[model samples]
Target: MNRRNFIQLLGVGAGATILSSTLIGCGGEPHVELFGWSGPAATLKDIRLKVLSYAILAPNPHNKQPWIVKLVGPSSFALYVDPNRLLPATDPYYRQVHIGQGTFLEIASIAASALGYKANIHYFPEGQYGNKALANKPVALLELTEAPNVKPDPLFDHLLNRHSNKRSYDRTSLSPNEEQLLQTFHQKTSDAELVFKSSAQDQTQLTGFLTEAMAIETGNKARDEETIAMFRVNQAEVEKYRDGFGVAQAGMSGVKKIVAETFFLSREKLEKNPAGFGEQAVDITHAAAESTATFAWLTTKSNQRIDQIKIGRDYCRINLQTTAMGLAQHPMSQILQEYDDMLPLQKSFKEGYGIVPNDTVQMLFRLGRAKPTTHSPRRTLDSIISV
Candidate 1:
């Protein structure tokens, strides 16, 4: 089915049946309120803030917007992580958090280049991370220097257009040229490699793995509760928090949306029906994975903080490229998550991907043609900027 028909079906349960009520809805404000901040930033006299505004649009885990920026000078800012935003249950070691910071930095650099400035980034100016969790160390110090000759990033134009598409994707495969384009796009700072798999066998295997991972996560009370806490059930809660996962992000409408918000998205209801909810979660994830036309991952030789951040930057670039190619991408790295319960899945994932024991798979995602999706709500810049 075409994008329009698919979207209409989503609202009416015509094509794909009601997988999960939480996964159906167009619940919040429509005009991209948080994204609107970019307009003023682009025209603002303060170049640093202008670029930083675009950086805020970068994709982060759960839209946490973990970045904390302090305007230290006319053209520079100090980047820090908000301790409260850490995903202790899913990402106990802050690996994903650091990767998220890297994604922000990459977007900031691209935005700066688009505005005719060269961004100079210094990572971990204070010190490096210890073995387990991230310490009080700052993520980066960004300084922009005016360079009129600097060309804009090709992917920069798609920054606003890019979004994480969570809908069930079309089964049509990407063209050879498109596949080659994704494989060729490279980031120089880090030694991470982008790997793509589009075979039917690979897709089927991945679907099973992802489905199992979802079951594992939803079965565990603590981990499941962490996710449940982040579910913004209605438009009011979505706008209020503007950070957590919500039904509003799903882009549904009409009766289906109303039903989803009232029933499936309710935290209390989910808690009462843990088994049913877990089954729905697995079903939804399985369907999404089965719909994939391609699967891509980023692997690095090391799992150091710098490596984690580097992979995040690469992941951001990949998202932009996918957007430019008129394709949708969704990260499904639950199996690669660094938690005790996830250890076995992680080992299997590494081995399946042919990654060396010393190497780490930093990111994994499904890619395919998909209908247009609504952008997730974001916290305003004021909320994230340090005083």
Candidate 2:
């Protein structure tokens, strides 16, 4: 049967019926409240919420926005991990989640600086925990204090524009000076080592590792389901969830988005059988990796919870710095994931790069020029507040 007939017949049942409207609705570029970023300065209200307004926009894995804020005082709040918002299948160690906590904290600090306040973040306030385990401890105890002389962070200006660009790059490398600027742009808040692999041979090998890693990642049913659960199939889903990613975030637009959503994309199909989706993901990963000419990763000497969070802060700054330089950056973290299936490739990748055996590679991503992709949506501030 043709796609139309198949869809109509499937519509008779519950699962396929919902796709009718969502399929066509995906074509329009509706104004989503989540994508419209009005930073803390616009509200001028509660200091906690004001700082949080921008903090919610921090780059996170799968756009999960896995953070919980509890109001501790008039000017203070505590950040916790929303255990529900974790990638257990892909990120078994909760390392990425803690990293996400770090990014959130970084953005909150920057927002406070821009708003004439200093955000003092005390890590693991209730006490630290093991990186391999999740605990009831607070990730950070943040206090917002008035500081009339606070200097706004330069990266703060790029907050609204910084995004994880996923489109194929222009196949170019950064100049030696550009690389030096990145190498030297260390902030006092973080001490992670930032390493780059942009030489012709390094790029080729890293690209192969990236593509193979993705192939391994999508080869599992549970892993594919974990990812598809967070995938917004259309614009309606985007509006309904106000989080997660969609074709638009993949840099699909004009005819590309319409074609995918109309003919190929369907949530029901992906949910029922993810093998096809997995294959497509691998293909896309290969294409994206093959076209890129530069790769970078962050490493830390230890794998403590504090170390992961600190690395996250540094990654956030690099993302913002690259944005300021008109460079597009996208994180390809499949090889770095801590899942069982990915460990072998992970080991080989680390050894091949001559990286320290004990050091943790916190983040691995590509950097080059590409058109801006859609900004991943963020949930409402109310969604992340602890009652």
Task: Encode model 1's per-residue lDDT on 1-387: one tens digit a residue.
Answer: 333443444432312112222211111112223433334332468988778777887788877778888888678898888898878888888888888999999999998898899999998888877747667778799999999999888777787667787777877667778878777766444457877888888888888889988887777777777776676777777778877765445446456656667654666777776676566667767778887878888888778888877778889988988887789898986888877888888788778767787777788898888765656767777788887
Candidate 2 stretches greater than 4 Å from native: 1-38, 41-44, 187-189
Estimate TM-scores for all models: 0.88, 0.90
Q: Candidate 2 lDDT, tens digit per residue, 1-387? A: 344443332222121011122212211222222364444444467988888888998999899899999999789999999999999999898999899988899988987898789999899888999879899889899999999999988777777667887777778988888888888896455677888778889878987888899889999999999999999888788878877897676567655466567777789988987987787777677777777888888989999999988888889989989988989899999999988888899999999989988898999989998777667888888889997
Please give the RMSD to the true structure for each candidate, in Å. Answer: 6.1, 7.3
Among these predictions, the greatest TM-score belongs to 2
RMSD of 1: 6.1
Report the error of model 2 at residue 183, Å: 0.8
Residue 167 accuracy (lDDT) in model 2: 73
